[model samples]
Target: MNETELASYWNNNAPAWIELSRAGYDIYRDYLNTPAFFTILPDVKGLKGIDIGCGEGHNTRLLATKGAIVDAIDISSLFIESAIKMEKEYPLGIRYTVASATKLPFNNDSFDFATSFMCLMDLPDQEQAVSEAYRVLKPGGFFQFSIEHPCFKTPYQRKVENAQGDIAFEVGNYFKSANGTIEEWIFGDAPDELKNRLPKFRIPNFHRTLSWWINTLISVGFSIELLHEPYPDEEAVLNKPKLKAAREISYFLQVRCRK
Candidate 1:
């Protein structure tokens, strides 16, 4: 699908997404990913930053709370609209915009930092997005981002007991460049009547190899700073036994690159 179609798909899912995120029901972002991301994120106090693909703006709010002046952008108009309304309630100095990640609307060297949390792989034009991220950052600026681990998050991935009876993540089609895999986000807090009436919360994702990501950023003049494969922390696994799978096999990779 084209960029416009992809943006519309996110627009359609925005309402449910905003509700889920605000309620703190988004397990991945709320419970796991955000904490993991902050562990590696550098101090951003007083830094000018842009959060590419900011979605409903939970992370953007977090950035503002951490003292970064943020301009958060997403391709979906509905998502940006919801985020703007949220800004009124909290009154953080965050500017929300509806714009494509691949073609960021910003001046060169305008930001001290750039970020994309679990967003890069979902874009059709990841190369362009990475380039734009590189372009918008000032010299010595850092871009920090995360994505589903390329080695583990395959097109049709699974987990099973190995010969050793230990849980093994079975990966598939890691080398293929592909897209349109459905990512479902169920809003458990929704009313029963609304559940039946509303459509499934589905979004498309693109998959690429680990090397592709590193090379793309390098080609765009980013020097790799940190590579993190974040697993469930001890507290997380203690709270949720199923999180052991993540401890054994990393579900996401966070990286910091300097431009």
Candidate 2:
């Protein structure tokens, strides 16, 4: 899909995004609370930070609470509206804007730090977004990002099957590069009985090798500082058996870089 189409797609699903987040908050809590995510910036007490693709401004609020001057931006007007509502309900003093990641409405070296969570892969022009991130961040400023692991979460992989009436996951190709047309699923809040009744919506998400991400960061003049593949906490593992197995293998990758 083109840029306009991609924006519209996410805008249409904004309500679903909010519902899914509320329903599966714990599934994401660990990753969001990981040391790699929140502990990296020791001097953010008074620094300027920007959260690109800041859906609903959750992480943006976190940064503000840490004493950073936070600016949040997203392409979806619906998301920006939700974020503004959140700001009004629980003021974080964060600035919100409806803008594209590839063309940030900020000046050079405008922020001391920038972050994008689970957003880069979904963008149509990732390279341009990377460049924009680099442009807005001050020298020595950090730009951290998190995304679905290309290796394990790509379209060719991720499957479910019924084996002798018992539901089991059927793994698919992992090493293969993401090419040609593919269907990307977006999960939402739905009871198990109603899951199948819900439509399978598709989005265009590009999968890139880890090396590709490293090179892209370098090309944008950012040096990679840390890379993490987070595992579920022990409590979560014990409570969710299937997820325990998946966590043993891992699913998402988070990276921190400096401009």
Model 1: per-residue lDDT, tens digit, 155-184? Answer: 878778768757877788999877767777
Off by over 4 Å in 2: 24-26, 29-36, 39-43, 159-190, 193-201, 239-242
lDDT of 2 by residue, 51-148 (tens): 99998777788889889999999988998999999899999899999999999999999999998878888876788999999999999899988887
Error of 1 at 66 (Å): 0.9
- Give lDDT for model 1: 0.86
Q: Compute the lDDT of residue 134 as modeled in candidate 2.
A: 95
**How many residue pairs clash (N, CA or C atoms closer than 3 angstroms) in each of the candidate models, in the order given?**
0, 0
